[model samples]
Target: MRALQQCLTLAWRSLVQVRHNPWELGDYSIQPILFLVLFLFVFGGAVAGSTEDYLSFILPGVIVMNLVFVTVYVGHGLNSDLTKGVFDRLRALPIPRWAPLAGRILADMVKQVLCILLLLGVGFLLGFRMEAPWWGLPVMIVLLLAFALSFSWVMVLVGVMSRDPEHVQLFGFTALFPVTFVSNAFVPLETLPSWLQTLVALNPVTMLVDSCRGLLSGGPVLGPALGALVWAAIITAIFAPLSVRALNRRLMGQGGAA
Candidate 1:
């Protein structure tokens, strides 16, 4: 109970900080809308038959992509807090070591919700609609949020390990771009070579995307959804404690070797 309260307090402060910094929202809000519009309008017919078809195919991928990129910035936040000694100050408090990380993750989740709404609004304007029932919508959103949280653990690790936040941005793009695009983002897995297809089929990103599309289209979803959940659980189990330990070690004046 105490840890949860501390987390909420820290999360609220982090949100206020975000409100004061308009640039963060702009980057998350504007960029996804721009990319979705440009790709659906300009390249839809060339690649995916029509705008409507492309929207159905691409909207799921777009949402996943947005979440993936947004979570990457968690690393930047971590790096900034460390360099500015905010983390060091937090360490002096009686709060749990995981409290601040939990708080930041929650704040990022709220930002993600806003981002998804903006993207969905833009997508609707572009003629995107899910054929599934109303109940399915919330389920899809929950699954996507879970996937985002699972992925954020890795970002937290990177942020804890980074000595310089500036270079973290470059490393984020370099690492995430390949994992994202190489999945079932743009093209159908059937279209890829056997080896590439195998990789995409095994990619957790692809499973999440597939599950989301299934929920949206009212298609069968037993496999992809289950697979995504299992992967998320495994990732959380492995990284959450490691992250806590890393933060504690860092606060003790240990290097960022973790």
Candidate 2:
């Protein structure tokens, strides 16, 4: 119970930082809205025949893409804190060691929820509608967040090993851009070459985008959703322990240096 309280307190602290650093909020707000609008207008006719159709198709993909991109902040912020000695100060407190990580992740989830709603609102104004039942919306959100939580560990590991916050962002986005785009996020798999189709079909981002589309605009739900969950499990299994160990070693090295 006490640990939970500490986690919440640290989460609140992370949230409060946005007020003092207002530009950080723009990453979650302005950037996503721009992506949605630009994609809908630029590729709508060529890809999906109309703005409205493309809106429905791209919105879910945008959400998934944005969610993946946003996880980079976990690494960026953690790397910043580590470099700035904020984690060192937090370590002086009696709170559980995991609480800081949990708190940042919790705060990130809040940001993710806000970003999702913002995109949905813009998507609605742009003529995107949810074809699935109401429950599907919440389920989609849960699935996206669950995947984000698992994936954040990978970034956390990156953050731990990165020399500074800038490197974390550089590496995160450099790697993520290709991974998100090479998949069928913006276009149907059938449009791609047969050779590329098989590989994109295997990309986890394709599964996630397909699952989000199923949950939102109506399509095959179970298979893609299950694939996404399995991918999330595999990622967490591989990266979570590595992140924790790396964090411990980094902190211990810092302590020893002091």
Candidate 3:
């Protein structure tokens, strides 16, 4: 109970900081919107059939693309706080050491929600329409939240192991851009060579974006949705505890150094 209270308090503080700095969050929310418009308006007609057809296909890609990239920020923020000894001060309290990390995750997850909503709003304006009923919207949100939690777990571990926030950002882009662009996010896998098509189809990111689109398009829901959920579970299972262990080791190592 005490730990939960501490976590909630710290989480609120982190969220308040985000509220104060709206522009930074806005950048994350807006970049994908511009990318979606630019790509669909400029190249989509020549690449895909029509602008509307491209919008339907690309909206899901854009949502997951934003999510995959923005999550790196969570890890970088964690790294920054740890490097600056912010966690040191928090550890001085009687609360569970995990509370701060948990709080950070919670706050960042909220940011993910905001980013998704903004992208969705922009998508709607750009002529994307969902074929699913009203119930599907909430379900899609839930799935995305699960995905954000899972992906952020790995990033938090990366942040814990990182010495420089800039390097984390660079590494994230280097790793993420290929995984995102290579998949069926902005294009079809069938258009690729046999080997590239196989990889794009198997890419967990491709599965996620496809699953989200499936949900919205009223396509076969159970199979792809379950696959994405399973992937999220496996990732969370592996990385969540790993992140915890990494955080503990870092904190203890700092204590020894002091």
Instruction: Indicate which candidate wins on TM-score.
Output: 2
TM-score of 3: 0.95
Q: Candidate 1 — what's its lDDT?
A: 0.84
Residue pairs with backbone atoms closer than 3 Å in model 1 (clashes): none
Give lDDT tens digits, candidate 1, residues 220-246: 677999999999999888887787677
Cα lDDT listed for each candidate: 0.84, 0.93, 0.84
Evaluation by TM-score, superior candidate among 2 and 3: 2
How does each model score on TM-score? 0.94, 0.98, 0.95
lDDT minimum window of 10 residues, candidate 1:
249-258
Query: Model 3 segments beyond 4 Å from truth?
Result: none
Query: Compared with the true structure, what per-residue lDDT tens digits does model 2 show for residues 1-258?
Result: 999999999999999999999999888999999999999899999999998888888998899899999899999989989999999999999999999999999999999999999999998888888888889999999999999999899899989999998999999999889989999999999999999999999888899899999888889989998988999999999999999999999999999999
lDDT for position 235 in model 1: 87
lDDT of 2: 0.93
Residue-wise C-alpha lDDT for candidate 3, range 1-258, written one tens digit per residue: 888998989888888886777776765776877888898898788768799888878888888888888889888889988899998988888888778888988888888888788888988887788888878877888888888889999889889998889878887788888978889888888888887987787777888888788878767667777878888999999999999999899999999999
How far does residue 155 in candidate 2 sit from its true spot (Å)? Answer: 0.8
Backbone clashes for every candidate come to 0, 0, 0
Where does model 1 exceed 4 Å of error? 254-258
